[model samples]
Target: MDTLNSGSGKLVGLSFEMGPIRPPSEGGSYSLLIRVTRNCPWNQCTFCYGRPYDHEKFQMRSVDEVKADIDTAGLLCDEIKNVSWELGYNGDINTQVGTALIRRMPQLGNSHSFINVFNWLHSGARTAFLQDADTPIIPTPRLVEIIRYLREKFPSLERVTSYARAKTIFKKKEEDLKDLSCAGLTRLHIGLETGDDELLWKVKKGVTAEEHIVAGRKVMEAGMELSEYIMPGLGGRAMSRQHAENTARVLNAINPDFIRSRPFTPLPGTPLFDVYMNNELELLSPHECLEEMKILIAGLDVTSRICFDHFRNPSYLNAPGQLVHLLKQDYDGYKLPEEKGSLLEFIEKGLRIGEEKFLKTESYQL
Candidate 1:
């Protein structure tokens, strides 16, 4: 009564999903995502799917198990290459090229990219992502060994990255992070969400505002490129102002190399989802979110680059060029592209005059 499909060899290796919530990082994408571990190590987050059904017992596959998955992936890549040539497509004739191709094709939506496939097929994967939430929580030497193995297995692997928790980074000795970085752990992505203390607690982030700043500095100091994810509207309807101001303060302290804006969306199964459905955690409308962002950008003191990388966010202020517009004026005299006059005139018409009439004008959406 074995229900698993073991005979076909079709679903043998580590598979992956690139879906609505999670996507690959900027500047780089993965062709193959070998899931060395399953489910998140920390499932207490108020917003997440846990990836796997139950997350209490975090698991790490043995070296042999991961190698077997890699072997299967290699075979899968060979099959794909044969299929490609049969279809008259001439690519790199190597695995990395195969991986890059797999990513471009839309039909392979949920599967790991060809790089992952070919890496598995040829020398074994060059780069690997330690799955679940906090892979850095794994012992440093063990992570180092995994990285060293990956480098030896695939000589082209210039980088290996992982999802690191702020708490984990804070607890680790600085030497350990540097050691891991030396072992080819090139980058770390930490979800900073918001810098506001109240909002952090409300979202159940389990880290203090100071902890975020301290942990971020540590990562950069350890010689690893750090990308911090920030959620724009996590504070809900009531705390929007506080959220914006506090977030700015936190970012000012961290001065992260990359500040990525991810507009808050409550997934159905998460606690935030329930909060939205029951009207407990009222979301700020799009306009209000923009205002919050304006406050955030205006408050930014550090010259670190910011990126509005996620597609889900609709506000223009987050994009690369759009931030310049926000910098052009104070909040009072802000003008949109369609507006005809200087922002001062609009402010005068609305604020100075008894003109409740500007609301009828096309400038404001709220």
Candidate 2:
């Protein structure tokens, strides 16, 4: 069974193991996920649920193990390419339409369901995401090799992204970052959860605001698309102002390609949730979150596309629409920098509408 069967099972004998998930944008864009690392190196962010803090050890898979995964995925992609060509399904081969093709192809009904993902992949995915919390910690040379090998296998892929802790990226030498960017690692997603040092300390976010800027600038200098995540309610009520203002200032400093606002919602497993329960940390009401967001937007000066979003998007192919549409980013369909006056006015109006108002714009954060 190591060889692929056109309509039945995988061609390879080694079963692939999927690690933690990714941002919804990846799914919407039909980006395939390849887990290059296991769990996060630092999982102490108060709002996080990554492994080191909860379960699992921080470990890096050997290059050979990763290559095996790529090898298996490559065979699957190759099979899909051939079958798609044979079937005359010539549409741009991303996952969504590819799945549709599989469902329509009655001949494959007898095959295992898992095999369909590879078949779906055949629609030719040009984008992929290296996952589980962060992968930049993968030694730069090995990381470069992995990226190069992946590109060789999936020649059609135009970009590959992986989450990188701001500290991890900051630790890399300038030349390594530049060379890695050139080696096919197209984008870096850094969880710059809060750019305010005070709040950063409170949340145990390891890196400071200056470090965030340092890492981000290096990514841009290396010509890699950087998506920096900012959590709106992370400061809660006590430090809300600093959270918004400093975050904007930092964004201005780094000017990442995409500033994705992941609205703060303290989940049960995280330390922040315990703080919320004890009333030690005041959670931001939706209205308060809106107010903080307003401050952040007003202070932002970068040309980066601001995505008022998190992972839980509503419909397929639909980005959890922004507070207002602005400039668009090519990687994951982001909107940024709407007119300040009109945007604030719109937000104020939404605040007036209140929690009773069920809107995607207000509840975009999860």
What are the RMSDs of all candidates, in order? Answer: 9.5, 5.5
lDDT of each: 0.61, 0.71
Write down the TM-score of every candidate: 0.70, 0.82
Model 2 earns a TM-score of 0.82
Which parts of model 2 are misplaced by more than 4 Å?
1-8, 11-14, 51-54, 85-123, 311-338, 358-366
State the lDDT of candidate 1 residue by residue for 98-173, as single tens digits.
4444444434445544334544434433455555567788778777776676666656666576777798898888
lDDT of 2 by residue, 220-317 (tens): 99999999988877878899989999999999999898888666766777788788778898867656777788898889887787765544211112
lDDT winner among the candidates? Answer: 2
Residue 288 miss distance in model 2 (angstroms) = 1.2
- Give the CA lDDT, 0 to 100, for residue 78 in model 2: 56
User: Which run of 10 residues does model 1 get worst, by summed lDDT?
Assistant: 357-366
Best by TM-score: 2
